[model samples]
Target: MDMLHFGGLAVLLALCAMASNMIYNHFYEMVEHHYGWQRTVRMRVVHTLGFEAFFMAIALPLTAWWLSISVVEALLLDVTFSIFFMIYAFCFNWVFDIARHRLAARVVADR
Candidate 1:
């Protein structure tokens, strides 16, 4: 495929991912609140796995259609991406949480 077409598909996929992520996060927060679950490492792992699984379900068909590939091919590609993103998400959130806590503590100490 040409670069133009590939770029368009990439944008479309990104938009879809953003929408799905919003929906998934809303629901995940609800579940956490209901269960009074803390954002521990195990919870982060679960969150990443759930998001990846949910995203793969939504992206599989779109990817296959965009690339003119078989569903199996799309699954393989999505799985590869999912693995990378899972690690990234885990680390990003972990660091973000630490930073947020530190900032909050500083604010409280200033008062």
Candidate 2:
């Protein structure tokens, strides 16, 4: 495929991944809230593993169809992507929670 075609496909796949991530986090947060669970180290590990595992289910077929690769190839690609996103999701959520806490503190201080 040409560079343009490949680039477009990459962008589409990224968008799909982002959407999936958002949906997964939303529901995960809902469950956490319902259970009153703290974001402890164990919980974070669980969240990271659960999100990545769930995402693999969604990504495998999409990756295979989008790239026209075999299932084995897709699984390999998804595993690589999972490694990246697993770290990424952990850090992103950590930073986001920190920022949210700071913002909330500032708002309370101003009151």
Candidate 3:
């Protein structure tokens, strides 16, 4: 496909992924709150894995259909993205949690 088509597809896929992630995260947070789960390294690992698994389930078939490839081929192609995002997710969440906690603490102190 042409660059324009490819770019549009990329944006569409990204939007879909973002929407799915928001939905997944809402449920995951509810589970964590209900279970009183701390955001430890182990929990973060589980979170990352779960998110990727859910996303892959949605993305793999779409990828295969869009690329006219088999699911296996799409999976192979997605492995790199998965790996990158796994690491990215772990670090991003860790940092974000730290920042969030600090901000919350400051807000409480200012009250």
User: What is the C-alpha lDDT profile of model 1 across 1-111, one tens digit per residue?
Assistant: 799988987898889878988999899999999999998989988998898888878888998999999889988877777788789878987898799999999999999
Supply candidate 3's per-residue lDDT for 57: 91
Model 3 CA deviation exceeding 4 Å by range: none
Tens digits of per-residue lDDT, candidate 2, 1-111, equal 688877886787788778888898899999999999998768988999998877777767877887899878989866776788789888888887789889999999999
**All models: lDDT?**
0.87, 0.83, 0.90
TM-score of 2: 0.85
lDDT of 2: 0.83
Off by over 4 Å in 1: none
Q: Candidate 2, which ten residues in sequence have the lowest lDDT sum? A: 54-63
- TM-score, predicted candidate 1 vs. hidden true structure: 0.87
Output the worst ten-in-a-row residue range by lDDT, candidate 1. Answer: 77-86
The digit string of per-residue lDDT tens for model 3 on 1-111 reads 688876775786798789888998999999999999999999999999999999889888988887788999989989998999999988998899899999999999999
Of 2 and 3, the candidate ahead on lDDT is 3
Model 2: residues >4 Å from true position, as ranges?
Answer: none
Clashing pairs in 3: none
